[model samples]
Every structure is written in C-alpha cells, then in structure tokens.
Target: LAQRSKAKDWTRLIYSTALSPHQIVRGEPNAADREKDEENDDDFFTLKKATDVDADSMDATKETYPSDQLTKWDNEEMFDSIRNLFITGRNDP
Candidate 1:
C-alpha cells in the first residue's frame, strides 16, 4: 500500500483482469499480454451508467425513517436523560 501510494502513476499499476492461481504464483505479465492490455486502455477504466433501482410505488421518505416512535414518546424530560449520556451533555465542570 505504501509503495503504491508513493508511485507517480499509481493507477497504472491497477489491472482488473482475472488470473489463474498458476499465473498469480508466477507473478509476471507476459510482453504480448502487456502490449494487448496497453492497446485496450479505454476498456480498463470505463464506467457504466447506473440503472434506476427504485420501484416508484412506495413512499421513500416514510419508508426510510418512520417518525412514529418520536411522535409517540412526546416527552422532553425523557429525551434530556438520554442526551446526558453523550459528551456534549457532560456537566462535570
């Protein structure tokens, strides 16, 4: 990690190709393979557009964090007790 961080062009060292165990253990890129990889530079770092994942049927806001618990409690004193557990509420001056 340290060596990669110090490198001038650290991103060039990164390759997304899958390798077999034997190839990994050998730990060397053949000249022909290296040339081929260099030729197809655009294929390596190209990013695809993300698909819209939302179903659009459900109400996203209410589904995320239901405010029912906060509304039901409705007590400032109860909240004060919970707040004192944190550093901001520490009274030990």
Candidate 2:
C-alpha cells in the first residue's frame, strides 16, 4: 500500500512537472508581446546579478570514526555459512 502511494505521488510529481508553465513556455520571454515603443533603448536586463562566490565556503568535510573504533564483521563460521551470498558463489537455492 505504501509503495502504491509513493508511486502515485511520484507519478503526479512527474506529470505536474512535465505539464508546468515553466516547461511549456520554456525560454520564451514572458513580455514578448508587449509594446515595442522602447526598442530604441538597447539596455540589457539580467535575471540575476553576477558575483564571484568564495569557493572555500563550499568545501565539505566529513567526520569519520577512527579505524580502531570501527565495527568489524569478520566471522569464520558466518563467512562459511553465507559464502554462497557472494557474487562468485554457486547459483544454488
């Protein structure tokens, strides 16, 4: 039931995105049909101001547990029992 609900939500999201005004209109200017009285004015308009952003502020660092404190999953008996689960194991059920 949860999977169906999630699938429905995803389908709705995709459908809405595909049919949205942004996707339909695309790069066409919104005011293209406006009066051309200002055609002599050649001033260009930008949606956003261009600025140099600090690259150092975007660096991401991850904190990791020390090797000595890491959890180990090596067990001889368990390895022998589940060896078939590995990729190279025999394809028997």
46-93: candidate 1 lDDT, tens digit per residue: 445333344665545654447976674577766676676788887653
lDDT of 2 by residue, 4-87 (tens): 454444455556555454334343234643334255345576334333355565555876787654434365565566668888
lDDT of 2 at 21: 42
Give candidate 1 regions above 4 Å deviation.
1-63, 91-93
TM-score of each candidate structure, all chains considered together: 0.22, 0.18
lDDT (Cα) of model 1: 0.56
Candidate 2 lDDT score at position 48:
49
Clashing pairs in 1: none
Which runs of model 2 end up more than 4 angstroms from their true locations?
1-72
Alpha-carbon lDDT, every model: 0.56, 0.50
lDDT of 1 at 40: 67
